[model samples]
Target chain A: MACFLVPAAEAVITTVASKVMQSKESAPETVHISLDGSTVTEAVKTPFSKKLKWLNNLLWGGSALLAFEHVWHGEVVPWFPFLSAASNPSDAAEMLHEMSTAGVTMAVLVTVVWCGMLAVSNVIENRAVKSAALLPSSK
Target chain B: MTLLTTVFAAIICTIIWYRNAPKSQMKIGILCWMYWGASLMWLVDAVFEYAEIHDEYFTPAPIDMLNDFYLGLSVVALGLIIWLVILLAKDPKGVVKSVLFKKKI
Candidate 1:
């Protein structure tokens, strides 16, 4: 009976959400329009450059996941490139604690970088508003 | 039902209600709120019970705080359901009229 109610209720939410999404589909995609209309800004686009950009973000995300895994499993893979070795919970567990702490540090750093970007955007927006306000009268 | 089971039940209900809610609504609607409140009540009950059973002190984890925030979210979900039933029962015609007009009262 309890399980029955769970699904019964979820169906209701889904029905409502789909209806809302249908409405939103009619709305304009401002972000897509802005990005698509923008002129090329990159200095150079090499195959290596694209690969590095993708790989850098991938590795950063992977590192974060690895750090979180340390909170539970603990080991940071002692036998990465070599032969088999002992895999003890106590041993791996201690190692992971350090890695998880490292993950927290990296996440905090990423957040700070975003905060700086937001500040820059705000400064740019303020200047744009001033420019628009200072437009001369035709008469 | 046991506290843990009840908590599980509430979580399950919260998901159901959330998924059922009108996607167009901005989550503050009655059904969303009701589900949220009920879910939180159960979650806190379960966690407190678990800690008491294990004789463990409450040490806050970031994830735990996040879970607590989820409890807050479910409050709105459960409330939405209550409002849904009320609309269906008390003044069915009026409810339908308002819903058709996209005006929640």
Candidate 2:
């Protein structure tokens, strides 16, 4: 019933990680002189934070939607013993079971999809780098 | 039914993204990813539920189907809202910034 919590938890972690990575990344250079005596700088590579943001967007969006579904079904509530399922011993047990099975499966599937996106992005970035290396600079 | 809604939304967003790939600054890609990911999640949910319920899964009550369709629409609306917030905050096209500055001037 509360399967969305799993992904929500993961989203929280990734959001924190994104913030930390952003802090650690170097500041942009203020000035650059190109090989052709131009002052323009090359396009900077996409930062790790931006990639993490893609995952965050996916996880958060999915989790929020799923949570809304649960709330609609009255499985979740605002007050204490937040999950309606938690109010009953048998339902709570079933809820945990569902979390372990369906919830975990959903989280894992989303993460796998995110990994695929990362792989595609890496390939594109590599191709761009290769092409840029082969091309002659022009003023 | 929910899966179908998300699938349609994803397809529409993908088409829009493709058409404006050159000069669009709307960041429609984020919306596309969100809908596609949710569609995949719901697909898995449906598969697991189908495994458990077998024939019953095919004949969900009419009321339940309506509820699901509404839920799917709400999800799409929520995604759009989030994307709008991001777009306004980022102001990729400087539209919001220009409006605010124009007000002051």
Candidate 3:
């Protein structure tokens, strides 16, 4: 379950790293693992790691939720009635009730961060860069 | 999770969208969608929580879809921000004063 966080973080990193790159063609909305990860790690560690730790957390956490859902809903679901959100009078519902709240909060933060980035980027839209590579490079 | 994290994410998403933004006035329109989407998840949910606490039911299920849509938009925006950040970093002196700080030096 925890491993889910790794991918979420990686996704953010991947997105950010890709942002730093200008592919010869159109800018891609989502990118996959096309190369080694060492560069991405260094990029995150560098000063300009893109925001959304909670988002990454929520993202991976959402994935983790899916995994848990699979486990309880698949093999041993009936035994663990508490894990089912749809099941009446169960702990799962209680947790999701609270979790939805958290998810909403996560959503808001994501929105804010998105706005701020746009503000900054708007200011620099016409600015120049030599080469927008995918890894960390001090400039 | 933390204030910085939240701010960073917002900024990054903004930058991402700016980088790939269409060269039309509609760019702002698109951004508004992203803005609304990103804010929807938390702000609306927060309102929902408050309403629930106050014994009020503020949000409808249809509204929830709007929230998720914005969230997804923000994710795309974040990716755009990253691309811009790299561009800015590569040409700080050129890109900085105008788009970045906007102060004469």
Candidate 4:
């Protein structure tokens, strides 16, 4: 019933982590010096913060949709304990059970998918770098 | 049924993302990923619910089906709203930025 809370909690953590990482992250620059003594600096890659943003976006979006679904079914409400199941001791226990089971499962599944996406993204970035390196230099 | 709805939305978004090609300033990729992830989550939920309910899972009441359809539509709308907010905030193509900063010459 309250499975969305798991991903929502994860999203909150990642969003904070992303902001912290972004603050600490500096674009790694490559310096190139020409024979004429002119030097140029350029950032060579996307930062980890940006990649974390992809995961944040996925988690937040999915959690939002699931939360809306729960709200529609009246499993979630606006006040007090918030979750309808929390109003009762037995239902609260069941809610916790669902959270540990389905909730955790969904969160892990999304994270695994995100990991796969990161792997593919890494491959794409590598390919782009390779192709760019293979190109004839303008110099 | 909700799972199917999300899967359909994901497929449609993916197609649109591909059609847009190199123009990623709008970040359709984010929306596609959202729907895909939601679809996957719901698929797992469906599997679990099926295991719990067995044959009843195949025979959800009409009212429940209708409610699910409504919920599915609302989720799609919410996703679009979230994407729109991101687009407006980022002003990917400078559409909002250009309008807001248009100088009086």
Candidate 5:
């Protein structure tokens, strides 16, 4: 029941943090000059990119926490028993099989969903660009 | 079982996210975070359960395992829903906004 609350809280925090931390400069650039006189410039990150990065960091942090917890529970043992938490060899095998199947399913499902969203986003962006191009320019 | 399932999901998501770290978008990262968080929560639950049940925690009944499996799937599904909601709200590409404004115009 309360599981939904975490993401809602995260969304609010991320949104506010993104706004608060938005850079004032139009395009903050980083310039690097090489020995051969070639310069490489890194483009400034948009506010949205910054938010994505923050969310990425949050995921990494959560992954670390979960890994630790798994280690604690012996479900992820390094040695002989493999899944130390399982009652027996057969149980461990079953659990392993179940986990693998679920993992693959979840990954494929998430990837498919992400691809759909990306396609939609691309379409929207293309339409916006086309519309802007069609507008008459003021001399 | 719920914890293990989510942990597996989180691990898979993390690997994919890491592979595309430079250009990562579409908010799969948020889904990863949600699963990991749920995994961590369930891990604590498992720990407390083990403390109470001792050795019996390992030899769970087949029916109990099946139920836990269902619960795990539900959590995963709920996590995806929450991520979708966030993605829609953020509308990073303004897709929703454009569609709404387009209808009005």
Candidate 6:
């Protein structure tokens, strides 16, 4: 239930990062035009960073939807003891601890795996690019 | 139960996605994050529940556990659906756009 905050936090971080990146002097090179003629800007991100960025966006968006669903179901209230399912302070605390532990573990694991994957892909891509440069294509 | 299940599913999906994701594609990562995020939310909920129920938490009624299991599955499915919608809307690889605008002789 409380895990929703993780995405909310991510959304805030991404927004700040985007703003900072956009304000930099090298911002012009980051801009690109898509097929639909929509302006897209490069965020000066590595593969891992890009993944994290989008991941945050996904989490934020999904959490918002879930929250809306919960509210509609009357499972959550606007006042204290927000969740109708959580009866007391002790229950809330216990739930929070459990969720925090799981969330932290999952986040850490996903991030590590992502980093490893990006590293491997970057190596392979670099090798291919280098080999292509060496073997001139026939015009 | 649903929280735990979604957490596991998210982690597994992340591992598989990372293994197969191309250098230019980050969509899978988004899916990973979404599920993980939901798992975390459930986790917090569990903690509070456990605290309130204390020993009783360990001896949850069978029906409640079963209900939780189903809820967890639904969450996983919903997460996937959300991710798919995002992937389609973003069209990061342009596959959808290409199909939509293909020439028809």
What lDDT score belongs to each candidate, Candidate 1 first? Answer: 0.38, 0.83, 0.41, 0.83, 0.56, 0.61
Chain B TM, every candidate: 0.35, 0.93, 0.29, 0.93, 0.85, 0.86
Better of 5 and 6 by TM-score: 6
What DockQ, between 0 and 1, does each candidate earn? 0.01, 0.56, 0.04, 0.59, 0.08, 0.14
Point to the candidate with the largest TM-score: 4
CA displacement after TM-score superposition, residue A44 of candidate 4 (Å): 2.8
Across B6-81, the per-residue lDDT of candidate 6 in tens digits comes to 7798789888887886674547776676776566555556676787788997887999898777777777777778
Steric clash pairs (candidate 4): none
Place model 5 in a CAPRI quality band.
incorrect
Worst 10 residues of 3 chain A by lDDT: A40-49
Higher-TM-score candidate among 3 and 5?
5
| Per-residue C-alpha lDDT of model 4 across residues B1-105, encoded as one tens digit per residue | 888888999999999999986767888887887898788779779989998999999899999998888888888988899889988998878888888897789
lDDT tens per residue, model 4, A1-139: 9998998899999999999999998865452322222332233566888888888887887888888889888999999889999999999999999999999989898889889888998887665555545444523
Docking class of 2: medium
Best by DockQ: 4
Model 2 lDDT per residue over A59-108, tens place: 88788777877887888999989999999899999999988888888888
Candidate 4, which CAPRI tier? Answer: medium
A97 Cα displacement, candidate 4 (Å): 0.1
Candidate 3 local lDDT, A1-139, one digit each (tens): 1122233344466456545543333433332221342232111111222333323433443333333323433422446452344455565556556555554455445545555865675344312121223335412
In model 5, the Cα lDDT at residue A110 comes to: 33
Judge candidate 4 against the unseen true structure and give its global Cα lDDT, from 0 to 1.
0.83
Q: Candidate 6 at residue A112, lDDT?
A: 54
**Clashing residue pairs in candidate 2, if any?**
none
Which 10 consecutive residues of model 2 chain B have the lowest summed lDDT?
B96-105
CAPRI class of candidate 1: incorrect
lDDT of 4 at B77: 89
